[model samples]
Target chain A: MSEKNKYQNRRDFVKKVGKWAVALPIAYLGYELIQKTSAQEFVWQIDPYKCTQCGQCETNCVQTVSAVKCMHAYEMCGYCDLCSGYLRQGVKERNTGAELQLCPTSAINRSFIENPYFAYTIDEELCNGCGKCVKGCAAFGNSSLYLQIKHELCVNCNLCSIAQTCPAEAIQRVPNSKAYNLKDGYKPKES
Target chain B: MNKKILYILLFIFIGWNYFIYGQARFPKPEFDSGYNYPEYQITEPISPVWEYIDVAVLLIVLTLTTRFTLKTRSRKSIILISAFSLLYFGFFREGCICSIGSIQNIALTLFNDGYTLPLSVLLFFLIPILFTIGYGRQFCAGACPLGAIQELTGIYPVKLPKTVETILSTVPYIYLVLSILFAATDSHFIICKYDPYVGIFRLNGPSTIMIFGILLLVSGVFINRPYCRFLCPYGVILNWVSRFSGKHLTITPDICTNCRLCETSCPYEAIIPSDLLQEKESMVKSRKKFIIYLILLPIITVGGIFFLQMFSENLAMVNQKVRLAKELRLEKENEIKAISIDAVTFKESGSTLEQLFLEEQQILERFRKGTPWAGGFLGLSLGLALLLTTINRKRDEYKPDQGKCYSCGRCFEYCPIHLEKLELK
Candidate 1:
């Protein structure tokens, strides 16, 4: 071939090599990211039955405020005049009073439905996940109130602090599909 | 017009009076006896399977769009696909798990080893950029719901001045850097937090964000994808990749006839005019300016680092830890009359103030290290923009600006040569 053709061929080869040099790394990085993503096997969650209400969720979480929050099972509630979840153990009267409240933040809002029937609702914003109410309810009432990690608020930490310190071993890594274990018929594994 | 105004005023007066009277008629509830609880509705989260389906649909749409844009160059197909994307990606999906917001997820994952990124998020972030490298930004033409929403509303877009457009385009780079910085430092996802159109897609959000969404749509009527052009951080990546794509959309399949009929076709003013005359003196002057800018680039970058360091405290405020630290400090000093809820919570948790201070210091250290990188990136971008402006290129015919062009195929309808070729075929 002539001098011009040889130079042109060399330039074309360089251009092709340069294109691949940029393309290959990007393709490889994308593949690596995908691989890393696929290998993510666990999601942080709470086992309702195993939880002993140790109150570690209040302090041991990596998040400044723990992702664990109180969820009310409205169906399971008895709507009694006096609720174990809302009241302190020994009170003079079964009326709503500042001193008689079990929750430090007064998160449980009690409303009068009728003469003897009153509804107890957990005000989520004020709940600190200390499990004082859950502990009180399970000890005396229908075991309606339980602790579960709110997935929306959770960052899905790799090593959960609450899990590490859980005396009951209630916190466990589950599949992402079953991240939230509700109070309805869900059982925790016996350790 | 005067009568219409009087009628509107009269209607408003009657409505106001009616509302006042209606309020007075209803007796207030006894707060002591009965407390009304707002009905809390629990929304079921969208299933993981559906998210995977959305990803699949996205990939399929992107491939089809690339084919339609580069191979067929069919405007009709593009419009049809864009409408489909709007229905599925915009209305049905409610615009979450989008590529624009996924930048934060990727940044957070890279910085925080504790955080594991979901598969769908990684796919959402990478797919469009990978596609852009091979086939230009066919994704921008029709696949992206955000782009499609604004594109459909671009009815009578007014061409902005080149200088103003260039300056506005720099905003996305700064936004991208800030978004990554905030996400990496575990502050907040600024991109997702400030997304104007996601609120519109979901049909409810903070009133301020909803109003901002409405304003963006109103502006879209004459601004031609204002968010995509001037605010989208993901678009910056697409633009860079599309610049070097092997195959890209062109106005005509055949050679140009030097016809100026397609001159005013593009609403975005992306068409570059032919440079027929040689101005040697101006070129020499620009070359000197380019050299000067090259010399000043490092100095500007170093200055940016120091400037950002000065505002480290303000930047660190974005992190909750830093803000809580300050609050605790003030409370201890008696400077704050009321103890904040977060500070109260910290004190009650049985953790020592020294531990809190140590955590705050660590977070501040992260910000100190991260902000300088963001500043350096911004400075580099500025210098590069200046360098690009000073560098002159020779063009013999009207051509599309490779980085700015969306491959919309509007100019094809105005090209006589393209029309003639279609007729002959």
Candidate 2:
């Protein structure tokens, strides 16, 4: 065999090996990613049932305003004229007054629905996840107001500060698939 | 055979659309509220299973695209595949978990050991680069939804001057460095946050992004793949990889005739004229300049580091923790009239101001470390670009510029030699 032909064959072999060199690492990385995902690891989540409405979610989060937001269960809410979630405990009137508001941010918007019912909506942008409303509602009325981590806002931190300080052990790792546990059918325990 | 393939692709496209649009009926809620419910709720967190499906689809599409680009080299087939990808990856997927945005995920995973990126994000990041190394940006030709959207809207592309294009091209490199730096430090996903087309894909987002998307589409009418050309960080990586591609789509199927017929055919200005070779004296001068530039590279890098160090406070503010710290400080100084929600929330947490300041100091230190790295990388890229411009290489015929050419096959039709080859086949 000629020397040139041998060199040509070697070049071809090197080219073939180069292709595999690139392909193998990528294939291995893809496999690793798949394995990691399929492992069904735990994701950060909040248990509404166990939550004590301590307002730690507002302060303990790594994010500035906290990923935990007060979600109102409209189905569970009675839409009463005198909503415990919206008004302070010692308020004289049920009317929408700035001073009578429970939420420090005044995030709760109350509207007249009927003669006796007033619809309440939580403005998510303004609500600081302080759980002041949730505490008020759980104590005096239906436990419709609860805190859940908005997954969109959450970075899914490895060590959740809120979870660490939670008195009721309310915050726990859940499967990524069922990260959020809604309060749609939640029945508050009798105090 | 090509016609059959096109028909099959079209059929799959229609079938896929039908499958996506066909939703199963669910029972109405037992309790009805008087208030009108939103037609669609907030985006549900994507399940791991769905992520797996997206990865599988991306892999299949990438493989098919590579095969079609290398084997058939048919413009029509490429267009059909691109259109299908546009519908499936762009509209159907709603542009989430995109390769362009996945750069952030990969960066975060690399820098932060605690964060585990999903399988789909890894695939989305790697597959395109792998494909580019093997087949020279076949991913960009059609498979990229971002590119596909721009390509579709590119009706009458007017070529910009080479100088302007060169200057504009530097933006992506700087953007790439900044995005990676930010992501690595847990600052923000600026790439995903600013993705103009994400709004268009989901059919709703911030009005600012919506307006930006509209403006980009409008510009696309006269500029070919504006985002891909000037702003895509992922494109920077692909371009780097494609420089060493084993096989690439040639403008002419056989040999170039040097007829200059297809010189202006590429709207992207990816076609290189054979007259770029310079005289020996000019080459000598350029070589000298290249050496001088090489020596200045490190100086440039150091300068960049110092420049970025000056803005460390500003850069650190991208992190919410850092921003909160600053806000709290201002509130303490009585600079702020009302206590911000962030400041109030921190005070309510019972955490001490000293602790907050300590945390803020640590975050600032991280930024101090990260910004220099970003600046250094930016400097290196600038130097490399300068070196590339200074170096002169000989070329015999009009050919597609390897880095800039997306292998869209637009020039294939214009090449008589390519046409003849097709006819013979």
Candidate 3:
């Protein structure tokens, strides 16, 4: 009976010792990690400057519809009535015709502001992120129309599929505070 | 006329280059009319304060689960908590930065100083392990939404053959080694990449993963927690810590009646029955086998290191940057006939080939150093598992297997003693 009691006591001591021995290192790592944890939360976003309008954003998203949407940087818009962004390349007329518009979904809403200026606001609901308008806009107009991962739409996947297959490596992990990388304002805001 | 057309074509070509490089060809227009430009609209990411609430909620749920499983021994209460966990943690939170995936974050932060592990994520990874050490795998009982979802679906649980179960159980240890190895080398987190439940929780993912999630759920009805039992890398760590738990859930509240009713109750096959009837092995032969395995462990580890080291170069190609470097190098050397879009992008990015080659070499160096560590850990685990099978604890009653039991309280209902106590209450 005494021998059994002593054996149980020894087992208890070893078990207790083993528990803390493993726990301490893991807990210490947790403490160290907590100390090192950064205040800034980084989320995936498109780097507008690096983006080459490869059209992968439309197809490669894990979601049925891509989280990537075309954003109009009104600050950088040329506001031309004959905007290449609105009308296709080498179009004779600048009317809002289905055949003439660069956007496949006719997402670009062009409103006449003045004699030669038209405000192009994108209907995000309709935009497929094909970057057709962005490509045309960059060719002959101010590259104001660009694609960004809409926070409202994006599920914030850890490793974004679009980022993985992006030929340009345009998708970057930007501080969440920076939010959208607008064409008017890029992240790490280059000169 | 031809000369004139050629001159105009040259002008157009020059204009196109200017347009591409100029960034803004038709500059911001000056509007004489009073027209206001719309303010830039950008939506915010999910608030960080909510993340803190999630951590606090995780702590509360884990505490409740531990108490219910260990002290109360009520399967009904456990079911209630698991249902809530499935709704809140699984469906509401959409399962990002899960405890399972957090293993990669910790691994990555350990090796790469640049990557910061969030406090909430660190807590998510740590609290469960701590709770598990104190009270055996209470988290797996109901606190983990992944397990909760599986538990809920496990209506017609089937016990797998012991030999097949034992063989499949080694997968998580290998997964843990590979996940840590990938993270330490700054490669992508395969844990999150291959997670089956997150897509189900979010209701969206690649079609392949969605199909896999559906398949897992379908099989879960019969096989019972196919992932938790076989694939979860985090389960390997939790199982190890749980073996030394201060307290663990018991099948019977008091002395076992040995009626064998509770023996088949555990859906996870965690109830180890009495070994009194099993044929006993010769003591001398068993002892010698134990010593042989102990001696074989180191030799296996060294052999594993060498074997994995041989394939380090091939494994290094998993990095996207390394693959691109090889492609661009081949294109430059005229080994590849066609230039890919990635090669063009790399060329235009202003980074020289020398710099890319150097980065690739560094990444390969990391893989060379890291692969051996993973292989050694796997080999050691294999040796330990083999050794464990040879030893048998002489028990005359049924009991929950410490490392394997999820503490779900399923066996409590089967225990007539506990049922009488509940009836008295």
Candidate 4:
């Protein structure tokens, strides 16, 4: 009985040693992995400079309404009375009720600022990221209106659906703190 | 600045000086009015705090899973955990907190220096592996959202033939190597592209992915975790580690009576029945077969490299630049369409055909450097699998195969001794 107990004790000792031999290295690996990782998340963002207004951003997003929205660079805005992004080219009359609005959803909100200058704001709720206004602004006026992925709306899939179909491949992951790829290195002042 | 001077100024600012302005061509409006630049709000990503919470929840769930697998040993509790996992990790989090896809991130990190591995992803990848080494795939039993979703859906799973099961089980190894190759080469994330359940979690995606997801789920009704069994690259690693697990669930709690009631209880074919050694090969014959397989290993590996190298260009075509360059080259040489849109766009982009060809060559060069490793890994796995077939282990009683068993506790009720033990308790 004494010899049998000794044998069992030895076997248990060996097993325990083997278990730790595996477990300790795995624990070390976990520690190394944790050390290597950053707490700040990396997320998908669209580089406004590279975007071609291909209209893929509007349709290819996993969200039904799309996460991309028109972002305005107020510093870059010329603020013209005949804002091409808000109004279609060669409109009969430049009025609030004009039928020549370039945005299909009429997401661009134009308001009177000082004389001959209008402040154009994008209502992100309806913008749909179509890039129509972006296309218009790029072609006929100052390219102040651009498309950007709204972080709140973006689900950030492992592989962005928009990036897959983006003709210019403008979409990419950027560090969360430096998320936005605003034009002219512009950042909107946070309230 | 006047409109004339503004006309030539273009914004080419690359980084970090918030006041830089250029690119609107028209003169900046001189507003004497006191109106300030309207404060715009850019919504931030879901907080990093949520990531910590996710990690906490994952740790809690994994701990619960470990306790349940080792102590409680109840399928009902496992099912409850699976439900919670499905709703929380699968639906609420939108399935992005994934261990399976993290394999690519690791692969990307191995080759791409700029990529930063997130704290949550590394934890998600490592924690389960540690648990698996100790508890025998307890993570797969209920913690993994992917496995949970499929486990819930497997209502009438039928056991596949042994040959088919063995053949299909090798797919994940191939997928792992290929996905790593693609990620290392910066080609594309094929694993994410081919994920079957993410679309279902999001409720909307590309049509092909959605259809594939739906089809995989419908087929999973009878296949019992088809994706987990056959395609999950992470599962391959877990399977390997669990093979040496310290503690694994046994089919019977006590001595086997040789009644064989639980023989076919495992739909996953995890139950290893006590062998009569009826088909045991003679020592010399098995040794001879093992020797023959050992010799074939290098030949097969080189053959894999030779075969896969032939298709390097085709594999390289998955890169968009390479595909476009091929088309543009064809168009330039043949003058097929008078004005093809792609060619026009290609030319207008200020990139010459020579540059495009150079880029394509660089991508192909990357493929040339990467494909041999992928092919060699695949061949090595196949060769080892062939070698493994010749070796047989002796079993004295019916028990679950440690690596193959998911530790789901489904076969527990089939054992009469376990039922008696429960009744007595």
Winning model by lDDT? 3
Model 3's DockQ score: 0.51
lDDT of 2 by residue, B85-109 (tens): 8888777767776888888877776
DockQ of 1: 0.07
**Best-fitting candidate, scored by DockQ:** 3
Candidate 4, residues B155-266, lDDT tens digits: the string is: 9978888889988998999889888878877777888888889888878777888998899999899989999899999888788777767787777777887678898788
- Root-mean-square deviation per candidate: 16.6, 14.8, 6.2, 4.7
Ranking by TM-score: 3, 4, 1, 2
lDDT of 3: 0.84
Badly placed stretches (over 4 Å) of model 1 are A1-25, A39-70, A73-80, A84-175, A181-191, B1-45, B277-281
Decide which is better by DockQ, 2 or 3.
Answer: 3
Q: How well is candidate 4 docked (DockQ)?
A: 0.46
Q: Which interface RMSD values do the candidates have, in the order shown?
A: 14.7, 12.3, 2.8, 3.4
Show the colliding residue pairs in model 1. Answer: none
Q: What is the TM-score of model 2 when looking only at chain B?
A: 0.86
> For candidate 3, what is the DockQ-based docking class?
medium
- Give the range where candidate 3 chain B is weakest over 10 consecutive residues by summed lDDT: B18-27
**Which DockQ value does candidate 2 get?**
0.10
TM-score of chain B of each: 0.86, 0.86, 0.92, 0.89
Docking class of 4: acceptable
